[model samples]
Target chain A: MEESLYREIEEIIEKYREEETPLLCVLQEVQEKFHYLPRNVLGYIAKKMNVPSSTVYGVATFYSFFETNPVGEYVIRVCKSTPCHVQGAFNVLQALKRELGLKEGETSKDGKFTLEVTSCLGVCGVAPAMMINDVTYGNLNDERVREILALYRR
Target chain B: MAKTLKEMEKAKEKANLVTIYLDGKEAKVPEGITILEACRMEGFHVPTLCYMEGLSSWGGCRICVVEVEGQPNLVASCVTPVREGMKIRLSSRAVREARKTNLELLLSNHPLDCQLCDRNGSCELQELAYEFGVREIRFGGERKTYAVDMSSPSVKRDANRCILCGRCVRTCREVQSVCAIDFANRGFDTFISPSLGLPLGESVCINCGQCILACPTGALSEVSHVEMVWDAIEDPGKFVVLQTAPAVRVSIGEPFGLPAGTVTTGKMVAAFRRLGFDRVFDTNFTADLTIIEEGHEFIGRVKKGGKLPLITSCSPGWIKFMEHFYPELMENVSTCKSPQQMFGAIAKTYYAQKMGIDPKDMVVVSIMPCTAKKFECQRDEMCASGYQDVDFSLTTREAARMLKEKGIRLEEMPEENFDDPLGISTGAAAVFGATGGVMEAALRSVYEISTGKTLEKLDFYQVRGLDGVKEASLEINGMEVNVAVAHGLGNARRLLDQVKAGNSKYHFIEIMACPGGCIGGGGQPIPTNLEIRMKRIAAIYEVDKNLPLRKSHENPAIKKLYEEFLGEPNGEKAHHLLHTHYMPRERI
Candidate 1:
């Protein structure tokens, strides 16, 4: 929305100015900067890249890692895979949901944490694994989920 | 010498002959051709849903699958190329069952309201369902219930009936070079939408209606103004008049079982008169006026050091496209209003004045081979006559539909001449239906007017044909006038890109947004393919040759109009009513 913000996006696109498939790289960098892709940001990216906005929107919405909505400072992804479910992942999710006072896909009241479900973290060796932002929290229980969330609340 | 397609096909077949088996019979065919083409070549029938001619094929719909020996599953024939020693069966029991199942699946998601649907008779999906003998849809589930989008003035978007064939996506992107839509989201929730999921009206859509022509079902169609026209005709207090575009004459006969390129202009006027139109005029009359007006404008720019490369602005689609994409080149487009709008302006103002009628009481309707004309008529700047110039702008297809509703068969109607004053036109106006027609028409007048000589050859053969982009140099008054003609917005983009890069050398240009000009317009009759376009083009040229007056300046009525109402070409009086300006638009 700011002049500087548009200048910053132009810089990010300029990094891949010569790359053939620069759209994915530019979007990845943009998502890292804003924590999520804003609609206006995606539109700006499309204008800078000379690509259609539909393609940009498609790619942004396809990957689960890229969120189109505004997430809190910390995003909690609870694994809902078969291995995690067998290891009481539901109870771990319920503990986090109760602790944060938020349901799935809802951010906390204080903008501290957001909760959502993902397929798997590919760290299935630990069975019941959840991810907070980029860090994986494996072998989680109800008590451990509360204790882990308390640290972010501080 | 260039090789014809037939000669090239023969050479390809001879050079790379491959052994293949078709339904237990051995056959030799060309390699690298698609299995669908191979089957069609061998006279083995195969049904397809997503495969349209002149578009790229991806095996999205499995309805064209065939049984290939040694393969574990049936392969989609539309995307699979023929290989050496391949055995394929088109009508095997397994193949038929798969095709039938796929058809039922498409029907299961689609609403079964064919009787009340807009595309009831002309829908390809309906034809396929009938041909396959689909008794019922067994897989019943939650159908896609997306709301119909009536945001645009010209084309309507009904995603509820979409088959996800992606034909509209391909046509918008590949043919027109307007990437207004693409696949959004993914998998089951995938939808074709404009950039950033905006409504079609707010999006950078020129309303060319190519997507409606590309759609195989009821997913897309022209925003119908037929009811409005009908309501006006039924009102006893209102007087309704009609004008048909030149391109409509060649294609309006198609819906009534006439041939693709039959010139039925006289019968069209007769049908209009029978359908309750008080006066039936030709848009060709204003088309000749455009040649006179735009020709003088070109000469003015060339003489007075105005913007070189004056692009013709007769196509409303091309005008909007120039506004949104190439706004920096706004000065290059001529300020002349399109013939359809020009006819409307003069009809409601000049004609009403001459006939002692009120402009507010008279309704001017235009039947065009363009969907963009609908949007063009409703633009903010079109009401120069203190009222809406054109009351309704209907497509050629819509005009034929109205005739069918009134039981006025075009082929059965007797040939009749158009009314005097505004109905008279010349041969130069007839060529406006085809690509490069405006340039050809302009060159005829520009050459004669500049040199003060009668033209020997009326036809500019170099500017005529089905080529995407054409360039020619005409010597007028000993000055080499470099000119270019581009049809289809994609070709327009290439030529405009040259101008953007400061590499353009031409002094004048003609750009029409639809392929093959207005004959292949977005609002023309259905099944407008390359072959049909060439047929319509040849027929329009024939209409031009058969007419006695071949030049625009020689029209007696036009001279009379100038002497009585308008003083001269490009004069102040004519500028107030016939010329319009453009604005820069934001690309979504």
Candidate 2:
């Protein structure tokens, strides 16, 4: 049986019960456990924490780290900064797109990959880099990107 | 911090004095006061957009920025506390440039449809723009545009006009504790919306309209009923009648050049007549009726072992708040329809039958100092007369706009009287505009009715101030009737929580959603602050003081209403026409 969202939220709330302003930490843990934060889940969290639903929503949406929409098993972020753009990051992005058959901000039909364009991932030394499920791959080319995609696909 | 004026005054006496140099001149101010307050105290003007006096300062809008001699950057004077020997330039060249640039930047994204906006002359952003001489936007690029949300009957949200000062957000959180709206998205794409970006009507919004009042721009305003009212007036088949709330009479003069809280009931009636209403009545008439009916309900409840704490049900906003936040106490809330609704029901049923007119053709328009009254009037249960009891609930502001469009000046109109029967009311009815008024009005009649004695002094001074919550215990016929009055939803929550905890001692509670009752209502006036609320409260008391009839049950019209039309105060006919029910709602 699947674990109930309410029970999960309760455990998260209990973990931070002693902390003041535990909403952000609770929300972070909830998002970590689940790929995305559900609207009803947010409402339930708000009720449990005695915080206004709007305030919770504001905090959740303020930082881009928390995803409100459901994501696939792995989210691929292609860095599109000055250093990466100066390198062959654009071609690397196109190669990854072609390899995955997905557009930016689109999830694969198999629910295994979500492609996204993001700012620098703090790896300017290894330009033309991208991240996949918290794993960073720097100094990428079209061949390297396709190879990385194959590794994730399998 | 939004400290009360009384508290601020008391603090000033004991506050350590600090000397500050203003434009190279030495001035002394209370140490704990903010620079903005200190500046104003010294009779210097510091323009602000996001800073509201009775709300916590966000300091997000840099319009109130002033120069400190040592500080590298201009500080937001509203948030910066006054310090000793600090040099400040209120209107230096650099300060002016910064302010003007900020105003222009705000204008760059905002829609320039000032004349078409409901808050054209009253918009703080527009006022600042004009004052700063911002001729054109210097950085006009990438404007945020979104569809207007007319989802709520009480308020309209136009994202196109929002400057993101967060006054509405702060006011919703601080004043009402509703927190129904907040900034949902990040930079440029950010806009005020309910949780999960739901429309306001779908949220837990109580339709209080405090957000609309706190809004410094056209971003939030009442969903207008002016056009529908005009159409009703023009229709030959429709017999449109007008009813003005007690608060409307006191504050309607502010829109014109008259002073705040000027009694314009006569002139307002005259203007309604000019605007083509068949008859101009007073909600005060039903206010008197409400007291009678509510008093009877309270008496019967206390006597018959029904629900204790029979809360007065005059404020629609408070009703919605009860539905959302305190549904378990639904039985405690008085089932009596508000004066506005009661007037409509009577006008359509008894008055219509008496005048030999079809109820269908009778359009009841109410001029209320409430935006939630719009939602109340349109409730499916409001159609006790086989048609919607009230056709439209126009805000005082909206009614003033209509009068302006019709070229009817309230200041010039003669001191006429509201039409007969339904127009006549007692002094107790007039004070329904102020906080603690309904309780006082109810107490006056409750004491008199229960005791069967002519009370020498009618004034219930115990519950007649602008405190957030007021309590009084009265021995009516040896029955100790404990009562509490709470204005503003935040204050209402405090008492409701006590009831929810099963620790409430009061037998009756009067709750008004707005701060100063209807006088400081969301629909009252643009600048309905602490000063204006007090003035309106004083004016309402003045109206009560001078009236020949000081109590609700003493009104000749109300007595006649029961004698001729309604069988009794809470009789079968009266109950059917004058009562309604509430349902529990999903908070989010």
Candidate 3:
């Protein structure tokens, strides 16, 4: 709850105050600004919008895109869909986990990388795909995953 | 929305009629009515699990599916609107098979521990299973078992028994406007949980227990204090005393096979005495005490400009709601403790000392028509008697169960009177069980005290009814005293929001957390719909009409207690024993 963070949340709420069904947009902007939705910020938005905190929390937890907890600077989400699994996505995921020394849904000790398994990332053409901080790395094997991890190490 | 039978009848007069076929019988019904309403009007009982009268239609269970002519699949009757000449087969073979299959699917994941469940006999799912002749499970699978949440003092949550009807969610969000619980996850992992998956005790739950009344299963129930009460009564060193609330006497007869709104005050007293309570008192005694203290505070505020529009603090649920949602208005709320807490405070101190009994050895138990009373009695501020004032609080339902467990039949018991001093009350106190009763009772006393004259007409009809909000104005000694009454937390929120916006123009306001007040409390009998609530309210007025003393200020015992012990209303000693303060709470 830094002063700057509070000011940013207040600005976001003011921007969407008059829009119909503004909860989703307000939450999306909040997540984008803070990297994850903080508890106090969510409570502040609920009070400003005159909506129940439980309703806001419900919408937040219902969708997978919204995160309530903090994540690493670079979040790596490995696709675990049918097409990706057929293309040996497990090996790619294992390689990433070993290289980063992080388990699934865990952030690294240095807060540099977060490893996660997600449903289809909508890039099935490039099977065994993974995304890190908006950059997609697809057609991956152990060597490619290791190379991908090394690129972000510095 | 699913309209009740009464609402449907009212709509039939104004709306155009549509002819529909039910089991090949032509029936004319309201144009915009649902198939379930048509079935009910035609005397065809279509079974349903998720469909309630006044709540929004959620068509989740699919148990009320009916075959419509020319439709490929059976449509849920609860959600489908009737059309001209639409043929509906309510209990046909296909419909019955679909319902049974739906029940089997629901049971596939539900634990079959009905015999040991708290709602075994009265469970809607259990009743439906019996009606559908579902003796054996056709499909077996891995059952979902969740750890029960017993964190809250008022309500318990067992997600394993929930049918995902969403009734409790709707009741909390739509009716009470306290959206503390909702569907958290997606698909099979979905379960009702508080905000951020916090335990209910730590959430913004007001503990009104309206959700329990809406739940068709035992997934949500009152946390019982029966074991503790039983232990207190059986202890040789304890002098266990009981106090029954005004609302409990009118509604307790429902669990004993009696119709709703039956006044069994005498029988309730007899049953408690037979169950080994040393004395059976009335919370109405302290309800009378509340009026004396609160009415005086109101007059003082008006005269001294202490605070205008003094709000009542009789309902703990309403108090908690005010704390979380309207914290700024907490200063306007009355400082008097609720009648139940006041009785506990007085019983453990005044009564214990007068009767030559040690306060430690005296256990004060209260029988209330509320779930919030369970939480209210345990509050840190309620221990005014140097100990926990009220040791345990039980609901009317729990009291009935205890009576039955002791083999005491309420109908067969001889009529008896309550113990002296703490048992006697006025007709105004008797009406405290219903919505608007507090305002009416206070008006009766306030008007007389201000004018120094008796009131010829006792009933204040303007403030009495099932309306969500009620307003009335009275001129007392050339000064207009405007007042408003609101029941149900949703209605209270509306009124409070108006007050917060500086739009309120009243001198007093009475707010009850439950719809129709304590008679329709969360701990009342099951099936406590609008119809039953009205009946219970009528019975409350009937009790009031028959009583000799109708004003709280005129109660002989209360007057005696004030004259003998407490010198004056809202005095130093009375404030220490009866009044309390409030604090703001986090919205999350």
Candidate 4:
């Protein structure tokens, strides 16, 4: 099953072989298709692209766009870098942690939500920002976090 | 002593101050400070190779170049001083390219010998090469070649792999004040060498071996005594024994993925036992022995009017500095060999006779955090027994690499105890890895001897710190004893100057060449800085404080060595085995 999964990832990667930014584009495509980039796919891409495994790991680790492990139905990413920090991002993170009942980098026991802190989303003027699933939520506050998290609950 | 506040205020007004931009934020820096200093104050780090604290900046390696908006080219921030309103960009494309090119140039000449190089994993040049994305060396040039100089007892110098960044020269001159090593010849043929191109041992070079720490590559390393040791072990006739320095326990863990300064004393012993050594000992045992010898020597000096303000000769780097810069004060140095060598000398003679093993057959391997002990073990005077005392000396870093190669994870192993007699130590021995540890250890013993009573409170809080120079005075036996301690060669020079000028009078003084005693020794690890050194020093002290015993005089193993082997601490046999003499260095 793992070998077959690698074969499918390779096919998806080869689909955009000629693109200049194949890594970024392919990574985006794979994430859009599977919700999270698989570790084996990144390893396979590193071998096929002739790049260092560390470099590929660094790229995957650096941007919050990629994930090497599985995520739950809803992945909540709170901006925690300097700009967001100045605009009460800690409160937003706390709100998410309280709402989802999960700490940063941890998934809820029910597999309904996963929470994380990211560097930035280039939305400093909007103050505290978060990305829930595929859509970005800006100008977030403690109450707004509650309202957004309420929409995701069963 | 101050006359008035107005006079002090006037003096403060003369201080130089300059302002500069760091990542767009402005920082005020003192006038004579580099632009990098200003940037660092604003929490911006400009990566550098040729810049070391307490050493003069030589803009040779372009690693720390930054762009000034009005300036045509990037300036090396480590050397270039900040001007008022000067705007600098630390993350510019041109600056990055220059650094990348510089690394490429260095790599082009550097031999692809990383696999076997002692500095392989911790090399700064290798790290920068990877960081700059150097896929290949574009330039093709004939690499320089010269015979590897292992003539010195302490260090080995391989000129082939030298980057000529002048770090060793700066460390030798500006920090150590030795000036034994200097850049020789013209560009393209430029290399670091002793005066008149003599081998290090033959020249005025002191066997301090601090250059081993300053060097970025395998150009300067401790001569490996491992081959001779492996032979002794393979012969099946020898009883191979190993002893490790105190700092080794704290810093060796880093190479095995354990955090730096994590105490792994028990695990270290377990690994040594697993390595097939017949007995695993602690250099702390002899560090305790050093305190007893050095303490008695101090009392003898005070009573017999031999020499006042006796400086420690334990650090090979400081010993070299005295040979070059303070040759007249060579008499002021303690005559005892460092704990590592002292342990080896005794193990071959006293311990050998006790264990019923032939001195020739016994292999004494010392695991030290010092590169200088590599030279110390090879000294002509070290062989008190019929055979050479220490067959091989491995740095803490090297030992860790060996463990990794053997697939022994320190974290996986359970904590174990050291072998019976030679492995026992006191808090005094354990603290020898931190700054001012020797002075504190000596006081613990000497103070007891002076008072004719045991000390309940062993901690000498006054001297136990990370400061460069620490001074204290104590009243013992109705007499005042003044002591001073300094770590790092640059700091040692400052303390030595006052004593030389008759401005200060210290009965006993301790100095370690590296920043924080053995914990900050040159052979320990890379990125050994103020913060890291402090952490390791704290770990050493923690090991000391947690130990059940805290005084050197109380160690049962040391007492057993005296009773069953050497007879006494400073006995004739002890002197023959452990003590060594120094010589006047020649003009550079």
Name the candidate that leads on lDDT: 3
Q: Model 3, range B391-412, lDDT digits (tens) per residue?
A: 9999988898999999999988
* Residue pairs that clash (backbone atoms under 3 angstroms), model 4: B153-B375, B154-B375, B208-B316, B208-B317
What is the C-alpha lDDT profile of model 1 across B1-588, one tens digit per residue?
112244437857576888888898887777777888777777778898788766788789899999999999999998988899999988989999999999998888788899877788889899999999987879896788788989999989999899989888888877788888887766556777777777888888899999988898989999999999999998988778888898999999999999988999889889999999889898999999999999999999989999979999989999999998999999999999999888989988888999898999999999999999999999999987888888899999999889999898999989999998789999899999999899999999999998899888888888889778898988888889999999989888989999888789999999999999999999998878778999999989989999999899998998998999989899998999899999999877
Ranking by DockQ: 2, 3, 1, 4
- CA-lDDT, candidates in order: 0.88, 0.89, 0.91, 0.78
DockQ, every prediction = 0.61, 0.76, 0.62, 0.01
List the lowest-lDDT window of 10 residues for candidate 2 chain A: A1-10
Candidate 1 segments exceeding 4 Å error: A76-132, A136-154, B1-15, B25-28
- The sequence of per-residue lDDT tens digits that candidate 2 reaches over residues B378-470 is 999999999999999999999999999999999999988999999999999998999999999999999989999887778888898888999
- lDDT per residue as tens, model 4, B32-68: 5567766665578778887776567778888999999
Q: Kindly report the fnat of each predicted structure, to 2 decimals.
A: 0.63, 0.77, 0.65, 0.00
Clashing pairs in 3: none
Give the number of the best model, judged by TM-score: 2
The residue ranges of model 2 lying beyond 4 angstroms of the native Cα positions read A1-3, A78-104, A117-130, A137-147, B4-6
TM-score versus the correct structure, for each prediction: 0.93, 0.95, 0.94, 0.73
lDDT of 2 at B256: 93
Candidate 3 local lDDT, residue B306: 87
